[model samples]
Target: MVRFLWVCIVVAFCFSKWVDGFVQYSQRGDPKTEIINNTLMVSITLIRGAEAKGAVCLDGTLPAYYFNRGHGSGANSWVVHFQGGGWCSNITECVARTKTQFGSSRYMLPETGFTGILSFKAEENPDFFNWNRVLIPSCDGASYSGDSENKEAQLHFRGQRMWLTFMEELMSLGMRHAKRALISGCSAGGLTSILHCDKFRGLFKKSTKVKCLSDAGFFPDEVDISGEPTFRNFFSGVVSLQGVKKNLPRFCTRHLDPTSCFFPQNLISGIKTPLFILNSAYDIYQFYAILVPASTDPNGLWDNCKLNLTNCSPSQLQIMKGYRNQMLNLLKPISKSKQNGMSVTSCYAHCQAQYQVMWHADNSTLIGTKTISQSVGDWYFDRAEIKVYDEGCHYLVPQ
Candidate 1:
């Protein structure tokens, strides 16, 4: 049994017109259809940034796509997705693949018709580029979470945080159409979904709603990625637990890490943005999984790939330990409030990007090792019992 962390892929390329930069993948779900059905994943390009069409931006063009399975038509709504990688380039290919697959929000909506904010990676300009699609401030990509702090690339770390804020701002800017607004992230990104939920809550057409599926963002409270353990990091160098206790009010889950919003803690009690959390049972995916699993009742967690990921590279193994710890710590109740209710309308992996679900040999473990408690399928309509599937490639069997 392998505990698969859905946070996974990437590569560097020349930013040339011939640079047809794109990612390819397939998503799986277990939906029960009356018969066999084929819903073509649609692409709705919300903002075609004129800059994307320029040579400076990319000798070719920057194309961002948001994939959707449309619903009934109305105001063209959107859901901005942030890909998960430890704010580094190690998994650039994986994250890029996702962006290429489902970057646009309106592409697959239930025909209710929606629009997506899209972007293309300028292989040369991974550091920065013009927003060719509707810039949701949500600049998507992954970064290395390694402890080595090279002075030359500190700018990348700084920009990672700022870009997350930028994406939330972008979502707020264009949230005028949707009936409600939601922020979702997987793995470390699951942390982003929580951190930005409250930040973007009131600014949109509706308050930010969150669906946290398998996440204990890198820093629940800021642990000095430099050396500090999670406890002290929560206090931002305040080594004294007494100091942390004193700052309990300010120490809410979201704010525990001075660097991140208290997304985990705030998602449930303090914030009104309804949140949904899913953790697998009998699985030790993260160090936190050792702390928190199905509890007495494991629900949506299909597989705990962390424990099973022994063969993962040193980088992957360490990532599993850190995130698992974050997940367990996060699973603990902040104020003791139960979730409002679970919804069936969930996307398994972070499919909010375009051209997602790349199940190639090198990265196959990234998806298959994880298991789902419920049946899985794809391109199907979801309602109250919407199934949120992550990783895993095989097309979902109609439940």
Candidate 2:
């Protein structure tokens, strides 16, 4: 699965706009760097005084983010993006993550390239290219919402604290004065955007145009091929292990279990802030982890089919179609809301907004005539009420 994910990324990069430029590095306090080709490599900024606030990662390392200040018309506009990595549900899994960048800042690269929505090049990210872009790394192992600790394992599940600290730091850095602001994320980070959408709106004045974009964040509450609630069971473990129940939306938890509330399907309707959802109808992560997990297919019935959609048998294709319909059905309420927007295509992929090719390249995935970037821009600016859903499946093998 890891190899297949890299293949998808490499294929996306192949279709992306690449230019020639010099590589430059900056000192600690300075976060911005010149755009090298289409990618803007930004330095990481560890949250100041995070230890005092107990805002730490799984390994108790300080939380960090990469920032690039906006200029021109977008200077006052801010885009705070939550980084996405799969979550660790159990103590064993969490401990394992502590040794990697996902759970510890100690393992993170000093700097990372910002492409897709975070790109500085207007040609690559036309709408908000000049806006202040911030990428908060996913080191807490819980989509920035957990708030507990495991003393036995020496782990700190302080995702909620990390989120607060990061927001406070960004506000101090000038987000408080923003005329417009957007909070976005992909995968788990996408889930973070949904979970915090209204809270993010509360941070700004009523006049401030604050909105949220969740890319591939809608993890559905569905049964696996073996008729087991795999995702639900996994989420229950995460919520119980990390104490995520307290951070969940009250509107949802009031009636549903904390585990159910964790799924975006149960939380989207109550969000008062304008929200845009960008997801593929057949999200590959769901196909791999939820619908047909290795445990469920002990004989590896889906090994090849999961890696490539075209390799699926007729029955497998039927199951996939059912999954797609289920996702659309779950999104029905948002589809009717004028304040909300969506661009759910029948692509066999996940996390589109963070890739330059899928975001706005000439051959980018499209819903009707608009690329993901264009559709998102139209919604954010109120230029259009975008609600695009593709009827046909678009299958491609990574090469």
Number of backbone-clashing residue pairs for each candidate, in the order shown? 96, 0
TM for every model, in the order presented, reads: 0.39, 0.92
Candidate No. with top TM-score: 2
TM-score of 1: 0.39
How many Å off is the CA of 214 in candidate 1?
A: 7.1
Instruction: Please provide, for model 2 over 1-399, each residue's C-alpha lDDT reduced to its tens digit, 9 standing for 90 to 100.
Output: 999999999977765523221122232355756655556788788886999999999999999998888777987999999888989899999999999999999999888998889887788899988888888889987899999999999999999999899999999988999999999999999999999999999999999999999999999999999999988999889999999999999999999999999999999999999999999878888888889988899888888887788898999999989999899999998899999999998778878888888888878867888888999999999999999898654545431
- Candidate 1 positional error at 42, Å: 6.7
**Candidate 2 residue pairs in clash (backbone atoms < 3 Å):** none
